[model samples]
Target chain A: MLYRARDLISITSFGEAYHNKPYLDRGDAESTAEPVCSTACDGASKTQARNRYPLRLERLIGRITELSGPAALEASCGLLREVQRRRGVPFVWILAHRLPPFAPDLAANGIDPQSIPFVFAPQPVAAAQAAERCLRSRAFELVLLDLTNQATGTNRGGGDRAAAAQRIDDAALGRLLRLCRQERAALLALTDRHGDLAGSLVFTRFAAARRKGSGRSGARERGGSDSCESGESSADYEYRVTLAKSKTGRPGAVYREVLRGPHGML
Target chain B: MAHTACCNLFEFALQVLLRRVPDWEAHPCVALAHDTPQARVLGCNAAAAELGVQPGMRYAAVLEFAPQVYAAGVSQAELHQHQQRVIAGLYALTDEVLCKPGDPGVLWANAAGFALLQGSPRAWAQQLSMRIERLGFRSRIVLGFTRFGSYLVSAAAQTPAVELLQSVEDERRKVAEVPLHAVVTSRQSRRRLARLGIRTAGALVQLPRSELRSRFGADVELVHRQALGECELPAQHAAVPVQPVASRRPPQPLISSEQILLETQLLLEALVQCLPRGECIAALTLQLSLDDRGQRRERIVPANPTEQVAVLLRLLRLRLERAVIDQPVSALRIEAELCRAAVQQHQLFRETVPERSGKQAVEAFAALRASLGEEAVRYVQLVPHHLPERRVQWRQGAGSQELSPRGSVQAQYADCPGTAQMVRRAFISPQPLARHLLRSGKLIGPYLLSCDWWQSPSRRLYYYYVMSPASDESTSALWVYYDLDRRRWMLQGTV
Candidate 1:
């Protein structure tokens, strides 16, 4: 089922923010909890550890494969490359970076990465925005959108604030919400931590016990960080990661889990 | 054997009178015997035969047959016009009509498919006779599988029996007593057969096949079948042509070209509406008679028959522009012969893209040709000669020439003058420009094209060059050439 923040409009932004992140990372977090990640990290060689990434990624790939269905995947070059390293299943990934609005050229950017095995499909504009538009147009199954700060138009030069805000255009987000309501396929929009889309279904990071130390103390000492000064603790962050939204069904509902570990996200 | 002949001579003459007088009802006499060639009474009935007036008797002779008879000559033209009207009226019943609009009116319509619609065959025949009578003409309908059989039955008609033949055997039985004229054969052949005691159709039919073949050619056997009233000719459906719809001409004399064209336009609109739909006439003959005298004028306009009334009118106007009318026309009659439909010949090549509209191009050519005479519209013609002027001759309009390609012939023309005489260029130049300019600014003079003096009295070197305007770089350069001996530049061609 489709999940979008627009569907859960009545859910208080701060109230639902705690559960949204984990909901987005359900698939990744699930696979990382599998036996392969833990055992491969403990006893296996570096080669074995590297190889186990696929085994963990296989589960993630299986989930993506389920979501892909009949309509093929439309993903960016970056997301496709990461998926390829993890799963080993070939897919079309176009380098569609920038495109004019409503131009039919977006259609040309669609590539089947499964064809010409292992060759990443690159183009002048990475087709992430195009892929999101394709999902809105219902041209494909599960589309992967990297809605990082830069893609959200926050990376534009600070001098022209109004122009930069206009460039952000938020129309793409609105279309994504509508697509999540209508499309049978899943829409997995990935955003890094500290992204401004707190109200949107955000994927949160839950480090494994081994490498959890890399940023665990920082989370504990976050009283100084804005997140803590705002009274948002690690538990509060976890709460925001789990809640999901759907148009027809009840909002802030739990759908599935996604696990990520040393190998990669499930 | 010839049947003993019987004709009512006086009755025939009297029937002629009743048709002529406009106010014969107001006349005092019980009957008016109007005649010059012969005489008979105007108002006579079936009982008048008791007074002894037979149809074939003369005016004075009819007095001997019947004492009250008088006489006057027949009005031939009026009688003929009446017959033509009767024939035209037959178009309502059937398209197939045969009319002999002369004396003793005969109209034959083959009703082959009418039997099913009109009940029995005899009923249809009776209905046909009643219909003819309503049209003011008495017709004896004798229908059969063949024309000869039907004609013989019509000749034999007495009081118009509705059912002339009952069965095939009955027809064969009557054939024995039929006269010699009933069979379609030469008189000499009939006599030869009669000498052998084969007097009747049945008698000939009974002869041995081998003996009959040896005595006469195969045609004799075919005739014997026809005489027996057995069908030899295929049943033919009659065709009655529709009466042409007429239009009123203008009040003033058609002196100017435009006035005549306008009158033609009005008439063509009426004519095209009168023609049957989906049928187009190829040639329409327009006959115009002068008012002053009976001096006749005629113009034949050939056109694409399937064109609309507007297109056809324009074509007629074009034709009239070409014709020189000698006298002022009093009456104009337009009669068109339906042109045969054009059948599209299937081409082998599949159409891959849009093509030039040939019909539009042809129409444009026709319009230009109408404004100009044969001399104005010229085509390039090629002759068998080495001389440049003689080798290429220009003809006007359509000409017979084989349009094909042979690469070897082009090479041969370039090699020798003798072989060049046989290699003919296209008779028409689609593009009439003179020359091709080399990349260099200087003009290479026209290629030497001179004829062999002994074969033909023609020699000239033709030069072709492109002339660019000195002042303007954007304007197109004109292709022109000069004849060396003529010492003048001529516009030879352009595309």
Candidate 2:
């Protein structure tokens, strides 16, 4: 949403009352001009009510699992920048292969690509080791694991089609998940599709649709048809995120955002 | 009175030998000639002297005089190098220094005006003695009005002490107290003076000039005149400038990192020996040649200037671990840039926070960067923009500007009233959700936000403060925005 200068709230003028509190009490609502929620719902309605304010349902802190889609990487970077800005938490992105071609998208959103620390480990074992080292060092507040290529492989039966997919290494995934839990730092794991989310034991899985292995193929087909009809590049494809696992919040929460520019999502 | 200072580094040959083998000082040892047909002791320690084993004595004769004496030969080149180091150490005290090449044990400097800057002559003498001792030598300094007078006094004084003569009369009286054997150059001249009842400088000066000249010849007459302060014995001031650089090349190539470190340590010790007093190393450049015809160079600049070899070695070790050495090292060279001693200033009123040593801090930072990548250490900066998301930025390195809690808010907004405070919990991406009923009353806004009309027409958004039905205290409020063009509800942030 494009916000005009006058419409924006001066976070500084808002004072210590709202900082780090996360929620506004009913008393706070009377003192400020911000709108207040009157009726407090119980149990089943709480889930429905949380869906009304989707941002509140998605916990930005602690360990979070992001089901990868067309714009998943871009979204992760955007989230990192936002968290750093509002909370002053620093993050390190661990890439399993070469840096992504769409890294310039970070710069478009006011983040310097050179200033974002990235540990490139092409091998799954190395990537896990790097993540462990970074966590133990306690130098970074957030660890972004890019498992796009690391989690997918060709089918073991030597199929003629190179696109056949296999599950990622379970042992490495287990170790990484354990390290994340032990370190207790906020971890965001980005994958190519929701079907490739079998390895992690700690993630509370979430998918846009409650379908099996075919769910990813269906989404891809839909995205392909939409882009072809509109004559738009694959980069413009839309992404629908599903929380598969969350250590602190509810699972199965779906979020949708449009992939815009080279590296960010709106 | 004009002041002259003479520094006598007693048993200089022994001192130089002891610097290399310190334990030898306890034995009745001497540096002797091993290759000559008739082996001779070149220098002897106090223990050997007690047994009548002196320099120029044959090695056989020395052993016969003192059966337990230890003897070894030291090359003239080695002695000269050590003497040069001692001279370099002295340069830090004064510019005017005199040393006879043939007798490096004795040095004379013009100390006439130094007393005003260095306090009393006795204190200056003691300070100079300490400087010499730092260079691995023991010395005695004597201050007097005449060069010969000061030399005589220093030669007679005990080792590691300073003696100052207040005036020429005092110097004369001190010189007269010295025995004829100590001042005379030859044994024959000393025996002749002793036989003539001239056992001391005072008795020698009491003789008739013609009789003394006739009996003792021109050399004795000159010595008598010098001792009595009648002759002008000019001390040729030989001021050797301090060496600016020192290098060491091992005889064999080093194949192991440990070997290289050992060699580098020896070279550093040699270089430090040449450093002027109160000076330290500021920067160092280490160059290594590999067996594969390739070279590597690394430069290390300590955050705080220091001459401690341990600190420098620690940094070098860290750099070397990261260096990709394709082949064995053929040679290594280290060049140091010297700077004045560092002085750290601390705020008196402020409470002191416990801090890690500079070396430790640098090491920790390097380890962090290696594991997490270069951009891991960063600071936040404010950027000018209308969007709250674009109004702040993170840059590498700890910024000089303090991000005070109040300052952070002030920097974010210009018209901020400095009263209300708010914290933003942002989502990596705004989440789209299905329409759901809210237990809380109506939403806060329809606050219209539109910008960038020239580039794209889909720039309109309607933001609202929606209260979640969840009873959980953490996720109770959310800032949601609706895209007018897309007609979809998106979650922007949590408050």
Model 2 per-residue lDDT tens digits across residues B389-469? 444454554321221122232233222111111222333345564456323434555656676577754443544343432
- What do the candidate models score in CA lDDT, each in turn? 0.38, 0.56
- Which structure among the candidates has the greatest DockQ? 2
Model 2 per-residue lDDT tens digits across residues A114-174: 4455555544445556666666555455677766651111111344233234334567566
- Strongest candidate by lDDT: 2
Q: How close to the true structure is residue B103 of candidate 2, measured as C-alpha lDDT?
A: 75
Candidate 2 residue runs with Cα over 4 Å from true position? A1-49, A52-69, A94-104, A107-137, A145-184, A189-237, A246-251, A261-266, B1-252, B256-284, B299-324, B336-365, B368-495
Candidate 1 C-alpha lDDT tens digits along A134-166: 444332333444332222121234544533343
Residue B211, candidate 1: Cα error in Å is: 24
lDDT, model 1, position B169: 56
Alpha carbon lDDT of residue B458, candidate 2? Answer: 48
